[model samples]
Target: MNAEQALIAYVLRLADNALILGQRMIEVVAAGPELEEELANANFALDFIGQARMLYTCAGELEGQGRSEDDFAFMRDEREFQNLLLLEQPNGHFGDALVRQFLFESFYVHLLDGLTRCSAPGLAEIAARAIKEVKYHLRHHSQWLIRLGDGTELSHARVQASLDDAWQYTGEMFVADAVDTVVHESFAGPDLEAVAVLWRRDVAAVVEQATLALPGDQAMASGGKDGRHSEHFGFLLAEMQTMQRSFPGATW
Candidate 1:
């Protein structure tokens, strides 16, 4: 793919990740054990959805197509999406969901921090705005993990298991592909290798503070950024696209 195509793909990948994760998070809207957490979770979902909208719009502009954010979101088939496999995994339990967010946010904060420095048109601005909110998201999730980790023995074990279950998927976040290569070379975009280093250090520190052990390196699952996703992704796509597909042009 040319540089332009690579950039569009990269932006869409970002949008897809945010949109899918936001959908996953909203599933627990009324299910959070605490009312405060429920509200915060809902707000966090909105933050991600809002970021997805902005990034989609930017991608649409870059593509010079008539497509809008909704078109990119609700009109896409399962194979068209490029979200991370980690984001598509089921929310098994409260600790499962919490650990998932903590892990992703740890990497996302660093990713966005690097994106904020990208010279690509529209990317740096969006990344700059997003990093501000993501910093808070990272902080919130990190504190919660520490609390749950250092809590009761049961809490510690479950979240530790959650950490291990989610660790395999973590490798994909830094597995820079062709799009990553083009963006970095042409636009001074994120260096995933560098981000990986920062992510490892931050994650190790948080894991230590939580009195948790980090999972050892293992075979990493990938391909989501290439439009290949887990089995759960089809169901997610079906639910997210139902309204738009059912009512073509319906809008507020």
Candidate 2:
């Protein structure tokens, strides 16, 4: 693909990841175990949704399409989304959701930090703005990770299992596929391999502090970046797109 096409694809991938994950988090908005945490989760969900809007708007402009951010967000089918499997994973329990966000936000903060230096001016600007939001997201989730990991034995075990079950999906985040190659080589995007090293160190430190064991590398799951998603994505899209799909351009 040419530079512009490559750039749009890259941006959409970032947007899709955030949007899909945000939608998943919204699923548990009223279901959080604690009142404070419920507010925190809602806050984080909105943050991701805002980031997605910015990225999607940029992507739409890059594509020179009439489509708006809402069009892309609320009109797409499950197969069209290019988010990682981890983001779409079910919120099994409070700890499960927390671990999922912890894993993603930790990696995402580092990635956004690197994106702030990208060769593309627009992308760099978006990254600069996004990094601020993601910083707090990391902080929120990290606190929870420590809380659950260092809490009662039952909480610790449940959260640990959440980490273990979700561990395989983490590999795909740093795998550097075609879009990654194009963006890194041409647009000076974040280096996934380098980010992976730092991600591991940061994640390991948090896991240790949480009194949780690190998951062993057995096999890694992949393919969310290539428009492949979990079965759960359909349900997410069904709920997210219901209003838009039913009304077709109707807005408040």
Candidate 3:
């Protein structure tokens, strides 16, 4: 792919991850254990949706097509989405969701940091704007991870199990594919190897502080970048695209 294509792909990958995870969080909107956390979850969901819009707009422009952000978002099949597998994993319980976001936001903060220096000016600008929002997102999730991990024994055990169950998916985030390679080599994007090292350190520190055990590194699942998504993605898309799919042109 050319530089622009590579850059758009990279941006959309970030956006897709955010969007899918945000949608998952939204599923628990009214179910948060506390009122303050409910508001925080809603705010974070909107932040990811906003980022998704920005990325989709950029991708549409780069594609030079009549396609709009809505088209790219609601119309795509699960197999066409490039989100990380971790993001698409089901939100099992409160603890499950919290640990998942904690794991992702920790890595995403650094990813956005690297993106701020992208060779493409537009992509860099997008990343610069996004990094601010993601910083807060990382903080929010980190705080929850600590609270739940260090809370009552029941809470700690549940969160620990959540972390363990979700751990395998974490590896996919660092596995650089062809598109990522092109972006890094040609466009000064994130160095996946370096990001992985830093991610491990940051994650380990947080887990240690939370009094949670770090999960062992093992075989990682892949295929999101190559358009293969988990079965859960289809259900997510079905819910997410219901209105657009059923009505075709309905709007507020």
Which candidate leads in TM-score? 1
| Deviation in Å, model 1, residue 127 alpha carbon | 0.5
Considering every candidate listed, which one attains the maximal lDDT? 1
CA-lDDT, candidates in order:
0.92, 0.89, 0.87
| Candidate 1, pairs of clashing residues | none
lDDT of 1 by residue, 51-130 (tens): 99999999999999799999999998888999999999988998898888888888898889889888889999999999
Per residue, candidate 3 scores C-alpha lDDT tens digits across 33-116 of 889989998999988888888888888887788788898888888877999999988989888988888888888888889988
Ranking, TM-score, top scorer first:
1, 2, 3
Cα displacement (angstroms), candidate 3, residue 62, comes to 1.0
Q: What TM-score goes with each of the models?
A: 0.98, 0.97, 0.96
lDDT of 2 by residue, 1-252 (tens): 777778888898899989988888888888878898889889989988999999999899888878899989998877778899999998888888888989998899899998999997588898899899889888888988999899999989899999999999998999987778889999888999999998999999999999999999879888888887777878888989999999999978
RMSD of each: 0.7, 1.0, 1.2
Residue 28 displacement (Å), model 1? 1.1
Q: Report the Cα lDDT for residue 160, model 1.
A: 96
Candidate 3: residue 66 lDDT (0-100): 72
Extract clashing residue pairs from model 2.
none
Clashes of 2: 0
